[model samples]
Target: MSLSEEPIAPTPTTQQDAPSGFEETESVNTSMQEFHQLYQKLLVITLVLTGIIFISVWIFYSLNTALNYLIGACTGVVYLKMLAKDVEQLGAEKNRLSKNRFALFVGLIVLATQWHDLHVLPIFLGFLTYKATLLVYTVQTAFISDS
Candidate 1:
């Protein structure tokens, strides 16, 4: 066959040039819905555990308050684990939300210990770690958003 009889090459399209479609919007909406659901779940778990700790302290008054604080702290850890799982599933390239969640969790746990009049050095270290995480998250959010 002659060169003129050859099939023409398809034109290449740039990613920035692709037209927005229902698929893109739908996927974004689905991801946002998933994110909101996970956030609500984490909030509910934290609030419920906090309530349980309060009720246990008020009603029973049988256990050491440090132990009560520890129970709440452990529950907070489990809650973090749940959040981590969701973050992983979401495949988030940015971790602003996760870092804030962790920082708030650690701070609340420390305040709870203080409220119960407990002295646990290890918990302070955890707070420091959370603070570091918060710093990293802040930097990441700043740079990623600036792009």
Candidate 2:
């Protein structure tokens, strides 16, 4: 066929950069939502466990010790929330994870050390409650099947 007589095939449009399904962006949104939900669940678990443990500690140990633990637990909750926020913002607003979270730990330890009233062990253990919550979540997700 002659050049003028040949049928011209349509070219792909660059304007619509994404696929029709927008799977890439959609998956990101879905995963972010899942991460948010996971954060909420973990927060709830941490709070519930904190309350129970705080009460148990108060009953078994002493009110002062429990209060110390409470302080640490509160810090842990803040730290957890900050971590989630950083993770959510990762690669977007910020190129790397900020070291601000570590500052929270450092400040906690410093305060615990300086304050005669605050016992280092209890406060430190309380801060680790979040870690325990994470372990619980991992176990729940790994070992147990969704009902």
Candidate 3:
């Protein structure tokens, strides 16, 4: 039989039997969605924890302290969001965004430090709350697998 006379193979008619690259892209999209969902869950958890802490402090201490803590926690959340955006960028844009983030962080720290009425510890702790979300995500990904 000549090459031109050879029979052509049938193409996949279903998604499951599609090309490996297509499946891989689908998996990547699925994982991206999962990551986003997990990130949102973690963000909510962090906010709730911060709110609880703030309320407790407000009841025991003064309103000013509680407000400061709340402010710090909110700022931390904002910073985390900004950092995520920066991370999503590539090359020069990423570097620029990263530098801007760092500068903003430093400025906030300085401003908070200069504010004599605001307690440093609470503000600092509040700012670090976002790290808890990252830690939770790390632990989850380490233990959990898509398979």
Across residues 21-90, which tens digit of lDDT does each residue of candidate 3 receive? 9998898779768767766887787887788888998999889988888877888888877776675564
**lDDT of each model, Cα atoms only?**
0.56, 0.92, 0.78
Candidate 2 TM-score, true structure as reference: 0.83
> Once model 1 is optimally superposed onto the true structure by TM-score, how far is the C-alpha of residue 129 displaced, in angstroms?
18
**Residues forming the 10-long window of minimal summed lDDT in candidate 2:** 11-20
| Positional deviation of residue 98's Cα in model 2 after best superposition, in angstroms | 1.0
lDDT of 1 by residue, 1-147 (tens): 999999997654864555567558778789888767755655555555455654565466544553554454554555566566656555447544445565655766677567655545434432233234445556766998999
TM-score (all chains, Cα) for each model? 0.37, 0.83, 0.72
Report the C-alpha displacement of residue 101, candidate 1, in angstroms: 6.6
Candidate 3: residue 39 lDDT (0-100): 61
Model 1, CA-based lDDT: 0.56
Query: Cα lDDT for residue 84, model 3?
Result: 62
Residue 47 error, candidate 2, Å: 0.4
- Which is superior by lDDT, 1 or 3? 3
Instruction: Give the lDDT of residue 13 in candidate 2.
Output: 66
TM-score of model number 3: 0.72
Q: Candidate 2: where are CA atoms >4 Å away? A: 1-21
